[model samples]
Target: MKTSLAVASATVALAVLFPFAAAEAQQAKPQSWPGIKRTDLQRHDLSAPGREVIQVHVDFAPGAAVPAHSHPGEEIVYAIEGAMEYQVEGQSPVTLKSGDVLFIPAGAIHSVKNAGSGNAAELATYIVEKGKPLLVGK
Candidate 1:
């Protein structure tokens, strides 16, 4: 299942998760995710004063791979299309297809590659510190 990139507004839970809607604009900077297309969505402040939450849409080209990297904060990925072979530090690779959800702790080294012939997509949610970059290249 190849799902196109869909942009939706925030929800209550998402708002709660990412509370800084007031500073939504100009916060989500586009990222260069090798072999992938990334659409950065709204970024909001978390209930915690200095923390923030950001959401993004990522599409992996067939056989594409995202280089090993780490997030400054927690990352939650929900597979929306096709399948992906995902690996994290100290963990075996896992195949995540539609409906699969994976969580990566902050600073964990990881990478992902499309495991299917078609494209793959996922929703990535990040809970990070305010003004900090979301991803850190390893």
Candidate 2:
């Protein structure tokens, strides 16, 4: 009877703690958006103090959009396929085609949309502060 009670107590404890654990796990990773796929290509520590570089390949389904967000540092985006429109805060939206590049200043609020009828993709390179969330939604 004592062994069963102990097991029941442990189970209750786990049940109580599980949600907090899950929430922490979600915060540890970057936020995700529907219809957007992000693949981490590489990550390396930069020479600058407390800085790191992260390269990601992002694919957007037709007419998909990412909500306004900002990074801790600068982002260099290279459009790889199809067309994408980028809207940077306080600036006119710009569309980029294949092989085009755009530089986004650090902490600049921005959003992206797949402007073409087909899927669009871009390679994003970020120079950001280490140990901080790569993307912060505005």
Candidate 3:
């Protein structure tokens, strides 16, 4: 009888603890923004200490936008196709077409949108500090 009672007590404890554990696991996952698809193309450590470079291919559906965000370091963007409008803090918004490029200074809050009728894409190369998140939403 005592063995059965201990098993029941343990089961009840687990039942009470499981939800909290599940919630913590969910919160530990990284946050993903909607309307944008990002594909990591490459990552390499830079010669400079604690610095790294990351290349990503980003695609935006028509009328889609990435909300204001900032990076740990510089961002060099090359528009691959369609039109994209970029708004950088302290600067006027600019629209870039295919083959156009833009530079964003580190920690400069900015956002981008697909301004064309169709999908737009860009190759984003980031020079950032190692072990830090690529983007921080504003």
Candidate 4:
């Protein structure tokens, strides 16, 4: 009877601790977005579900242009090198030089075109909302 009681107590303790062990197992380790390169444009997913963020780098060749697209979250661009033209929905295209920043509202259609005859590069950070599309149109 004493051995039976001991076995029951150990079983109860294990059941209580099982959930914590499972939770610890469920925790995700830190990871970097693969395929990030400095010489070329790249898109990287930073987090999951409750923390979704996409990082896009634009390395434009001479006179390169990105077609109009809509973002699910508010998107912003920081021009790192060269000049480019920005066009947003209901707004005229504006010339943006290096070191300039632009704010794009959520669901706004926009495009980026390199203005200069040389290469233009930009580092962009996007705050993506859950279930929101990153690109609206082709």
**lDDT to native, each model:** 0.80, 0.87, 0.85, 0.67
Q: What are the TM-scores, per candidate, against the unseen true structure?
A: 0.75, 0.78, 0.77, 0.61
**Reference-based TM-score, model 2:** 0.78
Error of 2 at 101 (Å): 0.4
Rank list by lDDT: 2, 3, 1, 4
Per-residue CA lDDT of model 1 for 119-138, tens digit only, reads 99999999988777566667
Better of 1 and 3 by lDDT: 3
* Most accurate candidate by TM-score: 2
Whole-model lDDT, candidate 4?
0.67
Pitting candidate 2 against candidate 3, the one with the higher lDDT is: 2
lDDT of 1: 0.80
Model 4 misplaced stretches (Cα beyond 4 Å) = 1-51
Clashing residue pairs for model 3: none
- Tens-digit lDDT string for candidate 2 (1-138): 999999999899779866754563366343456678776667789989999998989999997888898999999999999999999999999999999999999999999999999999999999999878787878
